[model samples]
Target chain A: MQYIWINGNSDQGVSPDNRALAFGDGLFETMRLSGDCISHDQLHLHRLMDGCRRLNIPFSQATAESDFKLALAVVESSAHKFWRLKYIVSRGATDTGYFCDNTVVPERIMLLEPFTRDVVSLQQHGVSVIPCRWRLSHQPALAGMKHLNRLDQVMARQEWSSSDIFEGLTADSEGNWIEGTMSNLFVVDKTGCVITPRLDNCGVAGVMRHVVMNTLCPKLGLLVEEKNISTFESADEIFLTNSLIGIVPVTRLADKTYKIGQITRGLQRALNTKESGL
Target chain B: MQYIWINGNSDQGVSPDNRALAFGDGLFETMRLSGDCISHDQLHLHRLMDGCRRLNIPFSQATAESDFKLALAVVESSAHKFWRLKYIVSRGATDTGYFCDNTVVPERIMLLEPFTRDVVSLQQHGVSVIPCRWRLSHQPALAGMKHLNRLDQVMARQEWSSSDIFEGLTADSEGNWIEGTMSNLFVVDKTGCVITPRLDNCGVAGVMRHVVMNTLCPKLGLLVEEKNISTFESADEIFLTNSLIGIVPVTRLADKTYKIGQITRGLQRALNTKESGL
Candidate 1:
C-alpha cells in the first residue's frame, strides 16, 4: 500500500466519507501482476464488474477494463516484476446515511505491493491448513461476490498466528464446508470427482475457481461440480486456489497427511500451461 | 465529511491500507453531539469497546474514552451545535493479506458532519416504513457488534428511494423480523409486552435499543424483552431507535396506519427525561 492510486492518481487518498470505509459497500479484485500482463485479467474484470452491479455501484466492465489497463500504465515505471495489484471499487464519498444518492461517483482504488508471502508457495510440494472455528454468515444476496465485507475471513485468519499453517478451512453458520481463509477450497473425493462448495450460500466466487471449473476441468475431461461438501476426511486429495497463488494443494489437515494425488498434479500442470499461455 | 480528524489531527486522511477500507475489519460509533455534549456517550463507548474486543483490535474503553473526549475537545471551537460524529476504529494500516501484525495500532478516525435529515423525525406524530426485500445473514459470531461490515444495511436501504419512507424493516435469512436499515425496532404486542428482535443472530444492537430496554422500560414499569418478531400487522405499536434520532415511533407499515399509543408516548417521555438528566 506504500504505492497507492485512487482513480489513477498518486498521493490523493480515498475520501473519508467513502462508502467502502463506512459500510464496506464495495467490491475488490486481487490479481497477480507479472511484469506487464495481468494473470486472469479478463476473469477478474468480469467478477469485479458483476460484484459492482450486485452491490448497485455504478460501474461497467468496459470502464473497469480501461481503468485496469490505465492502472497498469500508470505504474509502468515500477521495476518490480511481480506485484499484488488490489483494485477496489466503492460507492464513493457520500454524507448521507444508508440511502445513497444515485449520481454519486464510484471510487477506484489501486494498491500495488511487491509480491511477498510468509507462507511459502509450495504449489507442487503442497501446504497445510487447519479447520477454522470462525463461521461464515449465509447471505445468498451478498454471497459469491468478492465484496469488501470480509470480517469473517479476517476473523478466520486470526484464529492461528503460527506460520506453520498456510490457510484455514471455513464453514458457513449451518456447518456446511465453504472455503479457506484467503483461498477457494477444492476437495477430490475417492471417486476422483472434483468438488467445490456451492457459492450460492456464502463464499467468494474466486476467479481461479472459475478457471478450474470452466477452463481447466473441461481441458482435462474431468467432472467438476459444486455441492454441499461437509468433510475433508473422505477426500482422496485437497487443494486451494486464488489468482495470486495459482493452485495450492493441501498436503495436510490437522494431523492427517495427504499425498499430492495425480489429479492435483495434473490440474497443477494444466494451470501452469494455462498461465504460461496468458 | 466536510470536517474530519484522524486521531485528533485535522486535514489528514486515513492511509490507503486501513483495514476498514480493505476488509471492513473495524468498528464505528455514530454518536450525536449537541453543542459540547455527546448523547448516549457511555453506551456508545461501551459498545465500541466491546466491538473492538470482539474483533481483536487492540483498543480498550479507557483509551477510547480519552480519544472520544480528545476529539470533542479538539473540535471545541466549532460553531455547529448539532453534529453527527462518526468515530471509526480500524485495524489501522497494514500491507498484508487477511493476517495482521499484532503490533499495528488501531486507527481512530472521527468524522464530523452537520446533522441533516431528508425525512421528517416525526417523533410525536410517527413515521411510515416499508418492509425491505433484502435479508440479513445470521452470524452469531458477529451479532450485536457494530462492526464496519454493513453491506446488508446498504442493500436493505437501497430497496426504496421515496422520501415518504422513513426506514425499511429488515429480516434475517430465516424470515425473522430483525431491525430497520438504520435503527433497532421494537414492537408492542396486544398483551402490552414490548418485544425487540434479538440481536444474538444478526443485526446491530444499537445503543438506543439498549437504553430503551434497560432504562426507559424499567423506569416506566413496562415488560420489555427480546424475541423473534416476524410481522407488523399484529403489533399494537411499533418504534425504532438509534443514538442520533433517539426514539421514533412507527405509525404505519405500508398501508396499515397505527395510533401513537400511550406506551410509546410514555417511553419517549422517559427517554427525554433520561437524556435531560445526562
Candidate 2:
C-alpha cells in the first residue's frame, strides 16, 4: 500500500486489543479510485453507515469523509492513476471478551494501494467460474452488512487455484445460489429479466449490485427479480458486480458455456458510459 | 492488559493490513493463569492448533509454547495471583484482500491482565440466564473452530445489560439450543444422563466442554449425549462449562427455575479436584 491511516492519523499499526482483530467486530468498504475521484463514494459511505448502525458501531460520516479526502489527496499526489482504497471502522480496543462497551469510540483505518484490474478485457471476453463446494451459513443478523466476519469467503476462494478461473460461485447450505466469492451475482433469463439472489439469508449486499438493481436495470426496462436462484437451469447470461470491477460477465461455469448475451453487453456499455459516470 | 507480546516480541500494536483486522481471519484462545500456572494449557494449545489447521494458518506448537512460556514468565513475576491470558494467532498482514497467502507466518499476540472470577459463589448458589432473542447462524464450515468471526456472540450478548443476568443462551436458526454467549450448555435429566447440543451446525466446541464429555461425565457414571437439544424440554437441570469457569449451574432460564441437582454438583466436584487437577 502507498499510504495507511488509522483514525485519521497516518499510521501503519493498530492496537492488539482492537475488537476488529479480536472478534471481527467491524465494517469495511473497498472502493476504486481513478485519478482523484472515488467511484460511488456516497453509496459506499451510506452502506458503511448502515452496517455501523446494524453492528451498533459509532460512525460519523463527516469524519469519515474528511479522512477519505485526506487519503485521496495522498493517492492523487502519488504517481499512480488507478488505486484501491480500503476504509475500515472497528469497535476500537477492548478488554479481552465478547461483551463490548458500546460507548467506545470506533477506530478508522484507511489503506491506499496502487492497483489495476483489466476490467475492459475481462468484460469483453468474459471469464470462467466454478461453483464452490463450500456453502455459506445463513445468519440473517449478519447476512448483508459487509462486516468483517468473512472467513466463509476466504475458505470458498481457496477452493481453486487455477488462474483461468476468475471467480468462484457459492451457495447457502440449502443449495440456493448466492453470489461470487467477492462480488454479487446476476443471472439474465430468456425473457431478458435479471434475477439476483435475495440477501436476506446470506451473501454480501454489494454497492454495485444495489446500483444495477435500482438504477441500471430499471432504466433498461428490465424486470429485476430478487429471489432464491437455483442452479443455472435456464439462464441466458450470468454476470458479477462489485465496486472495484464494476461488472464482470461469466461465460463459463463448469460444463456449461454461455455466449456474451445482448443484455450483458448493454449493461456493460451503460455502466461504462452513462450509469457509472466515469 | 499490563503486558502484550506480538510474534514472540514485546510489542503492543499490529500492522493495519493484518488479516485479523481486515477479515477477522484468525483464531484465539482465552486462558486462565493462576499462581504462575496456566489452566488447561495443553487443551488450549491443542484447540488453537486445531483451529489453525482448519483455517490453514501456519502454526508451530513449539514456537507457540516457547512464546507462551516467555509471556507466562513475565506474568509470573507480577504481583497478581490470578490473570487472564489471551493468545491470538492471525494469518499476519496481507495486501488488503480475502485471498490469503498460506505461506505467510502467522502473527501471535498474547495479552495478560489481572482477572478473578468468583467460581465458588457461582457454583454454590448458581446463576440466572435468559434465552437470547438473537440466534446463532448455521455455518458448519466455521463451526467448532473458535475462529474470530464472533459478531453473532457480540450481538447476542448485547441483548441484555442487566447485571442480574449472568449469561444468555442461544440456539441455531432451526431453534436447536446451541450454547451460552461465552460458554457451552449442558442439560442434565432425571435419569442421571447429560446432554449437550450437537455442534455439527453451530456453536463452539469448547475445551472445557470436551473435558466434561470425555473425563468428568464418565468419572461420575453419567452417560453423555451430544444431540440436537430443544430449549430446555425434558431438562431436569442445566449447567454451563468453560475453561475459565469450570461449571456454572443455571438456576433460572426465563421463568423456569432449576435447582442445583446432584449431577451438576458431582460434575463440578470432579472437575475441580480430579479432571481439572486444581
Candidate 3:
C-alpha cells in the first residue's frame, strides 16, 4: 500500500531504533476520514494531546494542525478520497535500554492511507460480541491514555479464531465490564439512561464514547454514569462505539440476544444527527 | 546511540508501520555483553524463543545468532568496550491495527552501547524500596512473556519523582509481589533459601533469574522456590536481578531493614563467575 511519513517532510522509511519500536514508547490515534477531512477532527486531536500530556510527551497543537493538513495532502496525492490517519510521537532512540540521557527529542510521524468504513456489515446488521476471558490490568496512571502497550488486547482478541465474532468485551482485573477490543461498550437500562464503563483506570476512553458522554447525555435527557458496570447478563440493551465506526449495535452475546432496542436506536440517530450536522 | 537491524538479508531501519509500534506486538531480550560475548547466550535465546512461541511470533535461532554477531560487530565498530544487547522481534507492518492479513515477518533490531550498571551506591549500601501502590493486572495468557506492553512498569517507575528512591516493588492484582521496575526481585529467608515470585500469570520470567535458579540452586544446593512472595517488610533479605545488572541488594523497606547478607553475596559471586566463564 501507499503511505506518507511526516518526519522528513517527504515519505521515507523509519529507523528500527525508534523508541516506539523498541519499548513501544508512543501514543497513536486511528481515525476515519471523509475525502480529506477527518470526522470529529478537533476532538480526536484533543484526546491525542491529552494522551501526550498524560505520558509526559509534549505536543504543539499548531504543529499538529499543520501536520494534519500535510497528512491530508499526502492522502489526496495518493488519489484516495477517504482513508485512515495514524499519528505517532516516539521518543527517538537513545543508547541501549529504556534509560535515555534525557537529551533526545521525540520523533513525530504521521501516515495517511486509504480506508473505507465497514459500512455494509455494520449498517445492514449489527455485530456480535463475546465477553472475553481476558481482564485488563489496572494502573490508574496509565489507564485511558491509549499508549502503545496493547498486547493485552491483542491476546484477548485472539481468544476466538472465528470470523463471525465481531468484537470481544474485556473486563478489569476486578471483573467489571470495561470495553471491547477496539471500541467502547455502552448499554442502555430499562429506565432509558445510558450506562458506560468508567475508564478512569483501565480501557481506552474512546473518542466516540467521550462524544456520547459529553454531548448526548444532557441533550437527550438521559443519565450517563461512568461507574463499575455489573454483569452483562443484567443489561437491557448493549452497543459499542469508536471513531472509525461511529456506533455499533451489539446484537448477541453467548446464548443471549439483543434486538436493536429503542434507546440504542435513539442514541444512534442522535450521533448521526451530530455527524451530519458537522 | 549505535544500532543494527537484521530482517531477512539486509540490515536497515524498521518499517514505519511495524506492529511493534502499533501494538507492542513483539518480544525483546536485554542481555549483558562483555568482551563481545553474551554471558549465558543459550539461556537468553531460550527465554526469547519461549516468549516468541507464547506470543505466536516466529523465532529463528540462526537469525538471532547472526544478529548477536552483528551486534558484536557494532560494538567493535564503537569506542565502548562493554555494552548491553537488545534483540527485538516485532511483526513488520503489512496491514493496519492489531490483526494482519497474515503473520508479518519479524523485524530484528540490535543496539549496543557502553553498558553502565546501576549506581554502586544502591548495590553496595542497599537501596530503599517502596511497596508500589499499583498492581499488575492478572493476565495469564500474556503473563511471564517479555511482550512489550509495559505500561505497568512505566507507571510503577513514575510513581516516585525523587532520585532518592532507587526502585519500586510491584504486585499482582492478587497482592503477591511480582517484581521491581526493571528487575526481578528475590528474597532470602533465615534458612538461606532464595525465594522469588512465580511468573505464572504475571511478571516477567527473567533470564538471569533463570540462570541463578538452575546453576545456583543445584550447584550450591540452595533451596530456591518460585512461590508467591509477600511485601518486603516481611522478608529477611531482598535483592533484584536482571540481565543488565546481575544482582542488586535491597536494604530498607518501610520499617524493615535487610543487611547485604552472605547469601546475596554468594549469588552475586556465582553470577559474576558465570559471566567471566562466558
Candidate 4:
C-alpha cells in the first residue's frame, strides 16, 4: 500500500497539525480505476473541485490532475488490472484554531491500491436491503457534497450484521427514503418513471447518480423525478447505484420483497453501455 | 509552533496511513489551560475516554495522562500567559480500505498552542451569532459524543461573514435548537428556571454545560430542564457556555434582545466560583 503526500504540488512528509486530522475539515474522492486510468475522471474531478470551492480550500486543477496521473503511474507499475484511487485535500497548518488557517494550503494525497472486486459485488440473486435505523441529517450546506465527516455512514453501516444484506436504505429526519450509506438509491414507480430522493437537504449526489441524471435518463427518455421517496411504504422496485457497483437490485426490504424489475435491469444495461463507450 | 508525534509513548515519525485522517473515525478533546494545567482536565479526559468507548477506540488512561502532562509541559515552558490544548485519538493505521484494515489500537496525539487572555476575553462583550441555514440531522447513535467528523460545524461556521459574529446556533432537522457551532445554549424561562435543549439526537454535551447543570443549578436551587426548545421566541434570556468562554450572554437574536437576566448572571458567578476553586 504505497502513498504520496503532496502539499499543493510539492511532495513532503506528513505533518502533525493537519486540520483534516484535527477537526475533520476536509474533502475526499475515491475513484475506480481501469487499465490504470480512472473511469469518469472528469465527473469525479468536477465534484472534488466543487467541494473544495465550497469549503474554501485552495485547489489547483492542474496539480490535482498531475498528482492523480502520477498515482495511476504507481498503480500501473504494480500491474494491477483494477484499483482504487483516493484523493484527500486537507486544511494544513494554521494559526492553531478551529477557524480557517490560511497559512497552510490544502494538502493533496493520492493513493492507489488493488481494488477488491470480490468484496463488493452486484448480487447475482439480487441484494437484500433494509430500512436502516439511522436517518440522514438534513444539512443543505453539506449535502450533495462528499466531505470527510462521515460518522453518519459509519454508524449506518454498523447497523447491518449480515453480509447477505448488500445495502440499507436510509431516510432523512422526515422519514422519507434518502439514499444508501455508500450508494445512491433509486426506485421505479408504477409508471416506469425512475425516482431518486432529492439531495438538496440531505444525502450525497453521487458521481454515478450525476451520470445517470445527466446521460442515461435523458438519453433513454425516461421520466426521472427527483422527489421524496418513502421506501418503507411506497417504493415499487428499489435499486442502488454507485461507481463501484454499477447497479444493484434490492430484493428483500423488511416484510416486502421486490423483483428484479425490467426497468432496473434496463438502466443497468444502459449504464454499462455508456461505460463501455457504446 | 512546536510539535511532536508519538506512537504509544515512543517518538515516531508519521505512519504510512492514519485511520483518523482516513475515515475521520476518531475522538478528540479541546481543553482550556489555566496556568500550566488544563481547566477541568479530568472531565475532558472522561469525555474522551467515553467517546473512545463508544467508538470502540481503545484508550489508555495512563498514556493519555502522560500525553496530556507532556502537552501542558510545553505550555508551562512558554512565556505566554494562556494556552489552548487539543488531544486526538485515532483508530491507528490500517493496511488500506475502509473495512478489513482492522487495526484496533487507537493512535493518540497531543498538541499545545500558547495564547493570550485577550483572545477569549473578547467574547465577554458578546459575539454576534446567527442561525445557520443548515440543520443538524438527528442520528442518536452518533449524537452527544464529540467525534472527529465535524464537517457540520465547518460548513456552519463558513456561513459567517467578517462582521465579527462570535458564533452561530444550529438546529436539528426537526427545528429543535441544538447548540451554538462550538458551544451549548441555555435560556432562562419566564419562571426563572434554566432550560437547555437536550442533546439526545445531535450536538456535543459540552463539559461546561454539564458543570452548570451539575454544580450551579443545584447550588442556586434553580430548576434545569433538558427539553426540546423550538426557537428564540421562547427564550426569555439566552446565554451560551463552553469551557473556553465561562459564560456568553446573548443580548440579541435576529432582532429580539434581552438584558443579561439576574438568574443568568447568578449562575455565571456561581460557576466561576467553582472554576476558580473559591
Q: Best candidate, TM-score-wise?
A: 2
lDDT (tens digit, per residue) of candidate 1 on B1-278: 35777866775666778899999999999988766778888888888888888888998677677766765774467776566788999988887588996898888787877675522347867888999889998799999999999999999898889888989999998789999988999999998999999888899999999999999999889999898987766799999998888788888898898888889989888887776522
Better of 3 and 4 by lDDT: 3
| Candidate 3: regions farther than 4 A off | A75-81, A100-103, A160-162, A234-236, B8-12, B72-81, B114-135, B159-168, B173-176, B251-258
My TM-score estimates for the predictions, one after another, are 0.96, 0.96, 0.88, 0.85
Q: On residues B148-196, what C-alpha lDDT tens digit does candidate 3 reach at each position?
A: 7776776566577566667788998678888987889899888888999
lDDT, candidate 2, at B139: 88
Clashing pairs in 3: A16-B14, A83-A115
Question: Local error of candidate 2 at B85, Å?
Answer: 1.3
Give the CAPRI rating of model 4: acceptable
Name model 1 segments beyond 4 Å from true: A74-79, A116-121, B74-79, B116-121
Q: How many steric clashes between backbone atoms does each model show?
A: 0, 0, 2, 1
Ranking by DockQ: 2, 1, 3, 4
Q: Put down candidate 4 lDDT per residue, A1-278, tens digits, no spaces.
A: 45555553334345667777767788888888867578889998899889988888877778788788776776777766667777888866555556773555777666667776652346345688778887776677788888877766766776776777777778887888889888898888888888898998778889988877788888888889899876445557878887777677888887788888887777777887766521
Q: lDDT tens digits, residues A1-278, model 2? A: 46888988887679988999999999999998877788889999999999999988877899889988987887778887778899988988877777866588899988888877777788889999999999998899888989999898988988888789889999998999999989999999998899999999999999999989998888888899999888798899999999888888899999799989999888887788853432
For each candidate, the alpha-carbon lDDT, in order, equals 0.84, 0.87, 0.76, 0.75
DockQ, all models: 0.81, 0.82, 0.51, 0.44
lDDT of 3 by residue, A1-278 (tens): 55667463765666766778777777888877765577888888888888878766655667677778876766666665567888887766655444544466777777777776565368347888888887887667678877888887876877776878888889987789999889999988787778999886689988889888988777788888887886875678888998877777889987689888877777777887776522
Task: Give, for candidate 2 chain A, the lowest lDDT window spanning 10 residues.
Answer: A269-278
